[model samples]
Target: MSEAAVDISTSSANEIAPGIPDPYSLPLDKIDVSQGELFRQDAHWKYFERLRKEDPVHFCAESENGPYWSVTKYRDIMHVDTHHQIFSSEGSITIRDQLEDFVLPMFIAMDPPKHDEQRKVVSPIVAPDNLAKMEGLIRERAGKILDGLPHNEEFNWVDRVSIELTTQMLATLFDFPFEDRRKLTRWSDVATADLNSGLVESEEARQAELLECAEYFIGLWNERVNSEPGSDLISMLAHGESTRNMDKMEYLGNLILLIVGGNDTTRNSISGGVLALNQNPGEYKKLLENPELIPNMVSEIIRWQTPLAHMRRTALEDTELGGKQIKKGDKVIMWYVSGNRDGEVIDRPDEFIIDRPRARQHMSFGYGIHRCVGNRLAEMQLRIIWEEILKRFKKVEVVGEPRRILSSFVKGYETLPVKVHPL
Candidate 1:
């Protein structure tokens, strides 16, 4: 470790820019800080305020995950995501289980022309027109799930609602067996959150688990390969215009990326939305009264909830960010949690405002060429779920404090207990 300590004393360190958050002082990634702390302290804003202020790209000496540069400001994170040449997500650049092989990661983890080519394959499928094609089905799926809720009973929102609906939707998209859908959720979580040797399981056991997940997807893929055409994401990926006879391992690798992409991230967003609305009852009422706002409200919820709190990016070449020196291969994590609540870019940066004019401007879905490919799909699921939720329940209130997961890679409630009563 360098004996040189960083000085975050500059005024700019306290704030990113006028009207936005103080990136310097926000405690965005101190996962040691509890979810209650996250909810109560606006620690994210403070951590980002400091990052944006004193060391926009300096290392976090105290992070147990090790010294990662917290890129708190919105523009800084954007720069890293878009400038794939300078920074890379191509391989182990992602902190999750070191990229065991370079064969095939997803467009999300790739760079340049290659990433763009793969992204184009399903871009049309998730486009507004294609999503509109699946809208009624998506809405109906949400309705069936919500309509079955015990009107007068209390339930954990993540388990009963978010997990069930998201896993089911992904099951529908991939044609995976619905009865075993929870397995998909688990595998996806393990793929991302197993972190770098954080799990107690033996390395062989973990690799076996990942292979087990890829096996199930293989079954699904084989079935799709032999079957007739259908209008779903699997079919799109399987029979894409640019795809050829890609190797099984490579195919499985990309499948893992898609599953991880399509599963846990959005699931957390769904769960986070519920927790946000329940905690801020006024915002909950805002949606209940004006259902039209569901579209805009989705943006607000994503901004406030800030699910998928941070993502790691490896610097490919030696570079200087916000005056801090970053050597080649150093791991840096962008704290979207802090960037989303940036005070300089937002009005009342600490409070949840469903009507925040720039709520859509948040970085939760990421930015640039490698921005989330499933963004539209995620929005579709969220909007449909909320619409049906509003129609059936007059009020959905939280019964207690929601608990966050232990892992920092994906930050969301483990359980969102709620009281769901009929309208």
Candidate 2:
């Protein structure tokens, strides 16, 4: 399906509801941060703050996605993330359960030996050697995109820059058809979007679009499976010992994983970094003064954005966390967005400091077995783009309010109006 054919919008989700009470005003048990509307309004911070302070391991007896435990503190989230044995990633990784009829079995949702084996198959794509080879190509693409931006004109930075750059990169990684690159963005959006986000009409529609994605990739797999091993992701999966025999559903699951992982997280971070800089002028000035801080600022951007807000893990065995007893099969959500702002772990947690010490120490990439495999690649893209932006533009000024995506899982932007000033 073409990107334009998919009508995903945040208009309905972005409407501010009447009498929105403060986080503290609500009773403890009544607080549910899983609502997508809160994220759409950028009002989830206070709710998470309240949970981190009073109930680090609070259990929501009810939510749109059903009962789940929220791990808000930095250390507590780290514990759950690292101890995959106690907290399994088996069934699903989001707060919403996967449709039993349309389950997609990707490596990120697998346990033990299976996950490790499947993950190892594609790890080489981002290895030190491969990334070094990819650096020049990425820089070239970033420069062209930046150079092409209209100067002294208000534009949607999310579409022109963030989506364009990341979608191009995803096309490169998958060796997908460059002309149809926007489909990657659409698929990623559809894969993680809340049903009520207006991204799709219903679960059936969502599944249908994803199946179209599956069919397209399956064709690529067929063509590559017979050819000599190539460097692209599809080639790797087609030729790899472990992934070569994956079922159609498993293949589609991994494709969605790679597409979303390669697109949304980095794309949102690109938009978020610009928004963050505009929000914190001092940091932008700090960056402009010493362009050397671009690399460091990239980590800070990821931390500040916390793009993929939370990762859900199902408890394999009953366990206690932060004094809360987590029963077996309970859905446990590690609120990475909240953890990135925990005062106990991050200094001046709410502030955006570019030269912050130990900047890479954040929960955005997750931890342990499932820590983001393409983290370095994501950082590299951010660094190169910022470096290029600095070389040409004095500032990418935010001219209007940024529209947030209505998704508690994928915290991102739908649109961010900006006007570029040449250096």
Q: Model 2 TM-score?
A: 0.96
Evaluated with TM-score, which candidate comes out highest? Answer: 2
TM-scores of the models, in the order given: 0.84, 0.96
Off by over 4 Å in 1: 1-46, 61-66, 97-104, 194-200, 227-230, 241-243
Measured by C-alpha RMSD in angstroms, how accurate is candidate 2? 5.1
Q: Cα miss at 394, model 1 (Å)?
A: 1.5
Q: What TM-score would candidate 1 get against the native?
A: 0.84
Per-residue lDDT over 119-233 for candidate 2, one digit per residue giving the tens place of the 0 to 100 score: 9999999999999999999999999999999999999999999999999999999999999999999999999988888999999999999999999999999999999999999
Span of ten consecutive residues with least summed lDDT in model 1: 1-10
Compute the lDDT for candidate 2: 0.91
Cα-lDDT of candidate 1? 0.69
The lDDT per prediction is 0.69, 0.91
